[model samples]
Target: MANFTLKVTRLGFCLLQSLSPRIAGKVAFRLFCVTPSSKPKGEKAKRAHAAGVAKLADAERFRLRLSGGGLAHAYRLNGGALGRRGRYLVTHGWGSSSAYMADLATTLAATGAEVIAVDFPGHGCAAGRALHMGMAVKAIAAAEARFGAFDAAIGHSFGGAALIVAAAGLLPGVPAVLPQKLVLIGSPSEMHWLFKGFGKLIGLGWPAQQVFENEVRRVTGRRVEEFDASRTAGAIQRPVLIVHAEDDKEVSADHARRYAAAGDEVRLHWANGFGHRRIVAAQPVLDTITSFLGEVISDKDAEIIPLFDLPARRMSL
Candidate 1:
């Protein structure tokens, strides 16, 4: 680990260790779901502003009422014909909102198909304080109902895991949330690993880990131990794009490797310098995503676009 990360981890453990396990769990959970109120300063703010402009350009902002409770905010960036290329869905990861995904959605909208970006429950305009795996699934289902069927879906980080979960039908009443073309940017491949990491960070130990696993099992009705991205990816018979930044400290590129195989069914792209969050804003990364989406919208009936056909993206050192 980097010295800074190690120091932060140590400090976090020291502070959480002073609390009871229950209180520690609560603190950890709160930390996990809370969204930041401020926009990044300097260059980050500039990039974010550019992204927001993309969202506002010929965009129709709307809201959907989720079955679980509150309203889910969305922006539909106008594309070509109403459903010519099929509706495209773009979603941000945990603790993020549709605004963060606006640039990609805007770029994809250039293909002449409406690109809809959503704010999941507990994030953005959606109501909630804590987000469970089940809630993400519900958010997707609600989006599908409100925005129409998605021919292509792009999810960042936790949003990617939620797509797979929705696809697996791990939860009841949700159909296989399949999109003809799917992209996962900086997404983790295993749920158990995330749970264990959270528990370890909060000094919850094995006891807390077990409680988390039990909660996941209770919600999804599946073995938490078997929660692997490869397993879920195997179940979906569609084109998938997986992008992982080599320097990402939050989620390693190895997670992307696990989801990638030796076929056109799944393609993996490596990015650098962008870290976990900025990868979504990098020019090369943006080109890579647009190249993939362009192909999907290029065709009629929304057939699978071969990954090999995409133009090369020059990675920086």
Candidate 2:
């Protein structure tokens, strides 16, 4: 019976591979998959876990109404008295809520940076449909309104792409709240390739891939062929850090390489072992970010305030 079950599983995978090469590639990508490191285990661990869970639940329950876009909700974590320290705005990926980033945010805040974790539309406390990149952009703007301009912005996956658009001065009519520095975690330079690879993984064929690409273009107002982060990376004019896991099963490391090729201002850090989402929680990645912040903060002569110095308060919102 065990042998039969193994045979069936192998056959199933083979069938999937044959159905879509992109899906097959996704499977190949999954071989490098790394789950997020679990929280510590102990009495203190239990208490901490419980507290974190409770805070997440409470944040989810709190709802806020958006003026033009309709009603939505968000999780607002006020990092205790960073005082005059700088602020960091964090955005999570698709199918994930702000809760997933709670660990990362807490860690960064502990480093004397004010961290605000935002829930994109339709994912966390925010209302709406899933994968709505436009709404996600708007939600980001709204969050900025509440928290003021961020010194640095970090985004994972889809959020990374949105951040790129925001930085490129693409979102017209929307208030430009570009961060002094930007970090793209597990972000792909080519949207078409990423989507195609993703669709293939889920057994999508040419027709499905094309349709999805069309919808993406319609929503973003950018064609798949024209969507190149390398070109846009130069326009950012801010120091950009591109961090991706070598073993990432989602966005490949090649994406990071392409982004690096685009400009000299971009910095690429490849962390091993950690997969897409897990990279956020990985200590090494956190350390890199912390170190980068330290260097940027120390370099006073630098035109761009190295994401560490807290900006003066503006009376007008």
For 1-317, candidate 1 gives per-residue lDDT tens digits of 46787678657755664555444555555564455543444797667756665566567767777664656677777643453344788888876777777767767777566778877766765666667667777778877887677877888999888887776677766666777678889998888787777666555655444554566666556766766876678667777889888899988888888888624588898987888888886789989987876654333434444432322211110
Question: lDDT per prediction?
Answer: 0.71, 0.66
Tens-digit per-residue lDDT, 1-317, candidate 2 = 26676566456556765676555544433331222224434686456556555655533233544435644455545444435567777888866656666676776777767777776656655655544444566667776777677778888987787787766756446565688778888987866676665555444455435555666455556566656776787777778899998889878888888888878889999987999877877889888877776534323444444443433422111
Query: Candidate 2, which segments miss by more than 4 Å at Cα?
Result: 1-72, 79-84, 197-212, 295-317
In Å, residue 312's CA in model 2 sits off its true spot by 7.9
Each prediction's TM-score against the native? 0.78, 0.71
Off by over 4 Å in 1: 1-54, 79-83, 262-264, 296-317
Per-residue error for 161 in candidate 2, Å, reads: 1.8
Candidate 1 local lDDT, residue 225: 71
**Model 1, global lDDT:** 0.71
Local distance difference test, candidate 2 = 0.66
